[model samples]
Target: MARGISLNRRTFLISTSGAAAGVAATGLAGTGAHAQDGALPEYAAWKDPDALIVHTDRTLETRREAIGAPPITPARELFVRNNLPTPPLSATDDPDVWEIAFEGVASPATMTLGELKRYGVTSTPAVLQCSGNGRAFFDHEASGTQWSVGAAGNVVWTGVPLARVVEAMGGAAAEARFLTGTGGEDLPPGIDPLTILVERSVPIEALDDALLAYEMNGEPLPIAHGGPVRLVVPGYFGVNNVKYVRRIALTPAESEAKIQRTSYRIRPVGVEGDPSQPSMWTMTVKSWITAPLHEPSSGAVVIQGVAMGGASALSSVEVSTDGGETWQAAELTGPDMGRFAWRPFALVTTLEPGRYTVASRATNADGDEQPRDFDPNERGYGHNGWDAHAVELTVS
Candidate 1:
C-alpha cells in the first residue's frame, strides 16, 4: 500500500509573523485591525491570529497587508473559508487512513490514501480564491461573507492526478458528462446530510487538470485546510475545489445537492435561486495593491500588488494612480508560477504630493480584461471590477 503523500517547495516569499494593526486613516489605509475576536471555534486559530480578520466562525479573512507581495500565500496567513464546521482534529490524525470512492468508471472502486499515492504524483500552483472575494465592493448587501481581496491565495497543491485515478479505475464511463465531488465534513445530526452537503459538479473536461490533493503549499494539508484528501480543480473558483472530498463520481448530469441546485449560483438581484442561474465556476481577472497601502512616506512610492488571469495565463497588468481614468502598464515580477497561479506586479512611479485613487486591471491570454464595474448579482459573487476595487492614497 502506498501512503500517498508528496510535497515540493520553491520558496519565493519569506514568512512574515504579521504586520502592525491600526494603519493610519490619514494616509493610504482602509481597515485598521488584524484580529477580530469572533465566536468561532479553535479550528480557526490554526492560522496566525494576527494575520486574519475574523468575519465569522467558519470564515477568516487575511489582512490585505499580510497577503504581502508573495505570489504564494503562506499557509499561516492564508484565509480560511470552510463551507461547514471544521471536522474534529482527531479524525484527521492519520493521513493514510483517509479513503476515496470512485464511481461511474469501468471498474468502480474505493482506495485508501495509502493505496492511491502509488499511482504517481504531480504538483500545480493555482490561484485558490473564493468566488466571493470582492464581495465588500458590491453595492448590494451580499448574502454570505463580505470578503475583500484577502479571501484568496496562490497555493501549490501536490496530489495524484484525477486522470491517474480514472486509469486505475478502468477509465470513466462513456456517458459521463459531469465530474462530481462530495465533501466528507461531518454534518449536524437530526437532519438530512444531502440538504446541507458540499458537493459540486463540474464539466468532465475539468478532470484533465484535477487532482486528489493531500498537500498544500508543500506541507501536510492542515485539517482546517482539508487534511486527509481534498479535490483540487485548478482554474476554478475556490468553492469548486471541494475540500475533504471523500467521494468522486462521474455522472451524466450535475449533482442534485442543494448547494449545487441553489447555493453559490449567480443571479440577478432580488431573484431566487433556480437551475437556470449561472453557477460560480472559473474565476475572473482581478488585482489589488498590497504595498504602499499602509502609510508610506512621501517621495518615490513604488506600488506593488498581485494579479491573476482567472482560468487563463496572465498576459498584462496595468496600474492607474488616477483611478480608472488613466492607466499605465505595470511590470510583472517574480517567477511565473504557471497559468493557474498569480503573478506579482509593480508600478514604479512617483506620485505628486496629493490624494489619489489607485487601481489595477489585469488581462488574460483568453482576452478576459478586468472591468471597471462588475455586474450586479444576487449573492455578490465574483466582484472583480477594477474601479470599485480602487484604493485611496493620501501622499504628502
Candidate 2:
C-alpha cells in the first residue's frame, strides 16, 4: 500500500455554487456532457505518434481486470513504459560476465550482480509512473512517448537498499549531491534489448529510499521488464527508474542526462491560467474514474478509481454530474501510501436515461484541487490536475 493515497493540497479553485445553477439533475443532463458506452473508449487526440496519452478516459490502449488481494497488480496486468524495445539477452550469460561499475565518486568500484546480492538486500512494493502521464492534453504539443494513463503500474520490488550499497562504498562523498545509473548500452536500431536499456539518475538524498530491485511482483524479474537489476525510485516518474542497470555513480550536481535534462518537469502551480508563462516546479492534485466508464445504461453504477499527490496526501474526492456546477464527495480508501501513488476509491449512484460525462477531481489535505484545464506547455511533461477524460455515455 506504499503507493496508495491522495494529494496534500488543492490544485485549482472554482465557484462551485455559481456553476451549479441551471444544471439539470439526475446525472449530467444539462451540463452539455454525454455518457460513454461500456466498451473501452478510443482516444480523441492521437495525432502525435510519439506520445501515448493514458487517462481514466474511455480510449484505453490497454486495461486488464483488477487482480489479487493486497492487490499486487499482476505482471501481465502491470503497465509498461519503455523508451526502448525489450532486449534479447542470453540467460546463460555468467553472472561474472555482467559487471556494474560505480563512477563519478571519489573512489569508484565495480562488482557483478551476484556479489551485490550477497550483501543481503531486501525489496518492497512501490508504484512507478510516467512523468508525462497526461501529456496528451498539452495544447502546443510535445515530442516523445505520448503515454495515456496506462503507462504506469505498481510492483513488488525486491532489491538492495541503494543506501546500503552506497554506504558500503565508503559512504557518500561530501561533494556528491546526485546518483546516476547507466543501464547496459543501447543496441543498434533493430537489435532489441529484452529489458529497458538506458541511463537515469536522482538526487543523492533520494538514494536512502531507492532500491536496486531484482524481483518484481513476488517473482523473479521477467525479461520483458527490467531483470537482473533495475533502479526503483518511489514517487517520481518511471523515467527515473532505469532498467537493466549496469553502473551507478555519485555526482556533484543534478544529472543533465537525456531523460533528466530534456524531460520530466511541470510548470509552476499558478500557471494553470496561463501555461505559456514560465514558473517553478509543482505537481497538481489529480484523480481518474476507472469504473462505470462511458455511457452507462440507466440503473446502479459503481464509480471507482484512484488519486495521487506530489507534495501532499489526498484530502477528499468530489464528483460533478453537471460539469463543474455541482459536487458530491466520494469515499477514499487506503490513504496510508503517503500520496505519491494512487489509492482506489468508489462512489455508487443511479444513472438516468441520457448521455453523461463522468469526472473525478481530488483535493489534497492542503486544499489544492485538480484544475478543469491547464494552459498548454511545450514539453507536456507533468499534466496532472486538469479535468481527466470525459467519457460520453448513453444511459438508455
Candidate 3:
C-alpha cells in the first residue's frame, strides 16, 4: 500500500495517503544512542542513538545492519558528517528567517528562507554518500574517518528548484561556469579562512538538478542534517550538498575555497593535493550486503543488500555467493525511485551448512560497473571494489 503511493506520484517521498495507510511514524528496530553523561546532542531527538556509531560530536556513522530493507531510508537512520563543527541552534533559532545571498546573476540579492519557498516545492530521491564511504577497505590508511559501508543513505529532499531561483534572479551570468555553495558552519579562530571554510563548487551543469532543500523524508530537515536550508545536487558526493547553505554563487570559475582547491581531490597515495587533481565531485557505482552479520540458520537464507548507480540510473544488481566466481541476478524490490536513488535488493536461495563469502555488484545505466579492486588513492575516496566490500558469513 505504501509502495502504491510512491509509485503513483514522484512529487513526494511518501504521500499523505501512505500515512493514512498506517506507515507514517518511524518505528526503528535499530538501536538509539544517548550520551554516557546524560546529555543529548542535536540529533538525539530524531536519531536512533544505538544504531549509530559515534566517531565524534561532528561525525556519526550508521550501522550497516541498521540500514534494514527500506527503499527509502528513515531520517533517523541517516549518517552525519560535518566538515568543521556544527554551529549552535541560537544562530538558526528562526529557521524560516534564515538569510541567503545570491550572486553572479543579473540581479544579485539576499533572500530569506521564507522568500525562497515561494518559488515552488519539489522532491527527488538521491543517495547522500560520503566520498570516503568505503575508506576502511583501503590498505593505505586514509586520512579521514574510516567508514565501512554505512556512510550513505537514500533519502528524499523537498525544496525550491535551483533553476527556477536562478531564472527569477534574471538567470545566471553568461560567463558563469560553476555553481558554488558556502555552508554556514562556524569557522574556527586562528585558522586561515581559505583553508577551513566549508565551501564547495561544482560544474555549471549540476545547476540543472540542484535544489535549495528545506525538507527531508516528508519531515522538516533536522539541524544536524542541514536544517534551515541545504544545497542538494543529485548524483554528486555528499560534500557538494552544503548544509545550512548561506550563499549560492554562479562564478566564471570554481570557487577558490580550500575544499575546492587542495582538499577533497583524488590523487595518488603519495602525491600532494593540488588544483590539477580531479575533485571528488560525483560518486561511482557501488553496492554492499547488509545482512547475515553472524551465522544464519541452517536452511533457506535470504541475502539482502542495497545497490546504487552513482551518477546514473542503476541498470541491474548481481549477487554472488562464492565471491566473484559465480553470479546471479538479484531482484530489486520496492518502487523505483529514479536515477539517483539506491535500490534495495534480495536473493533467496537454499544454502547448506558451510562458510561462504557473499558479494554484490552494481551496474549503472551508463554501463559503468563495480570493479574487483579499487585503485588506492590519497584520501581513499570512492572505493567501490566488490572484492574488498564483500561480506563473509557462516551458515550452520
Top TM-score model: 1
Count: clashes, candidate 1: 1
Candidates 1 and 3: which is better by TM-score? 1
Model 2 bad stretches (over 4 Å): 1-61, 64-71, 91-97, 104-107, 187-197, 264-284, 334-339, 365-368
Model 1 ranges with Cα > 4 A deviation: 1-40
Q: Please, what is the TM-score per model?
A: 0.90, 0.71, 0.89
Alpha-carbon shift of residue 283 in model 3 (angstroms): 1.0
* Clash list (residue pairs), candidate 1: 2-114
lDDT of 3 by residue, 112-192 (tens): 989999999999999999998877667766777666677899999999999999999999999999999999988878988
Q: Which candidate achieves the best lDDT against the true structure? A: 3
**Residue 90 lDDT, candidate 1, scale 0-100:** 77
Candidate 3, lDDT over the whole model = 0.80
Q: What's the CA error at residue 103 for candidate 3, in Å?
A: 0.5
lDDT of 2 at 100: 82
Ordered by lDDT, highest first, the candidates read 3, 1, 2
- Runs of candidate 3 with Cα error greater than 4 angstroms are 1-40, 43-45
Pairs with steric clashes in candidate 3: 31-51, 32-48, 32-49, 32-50, 33-49, 33-50
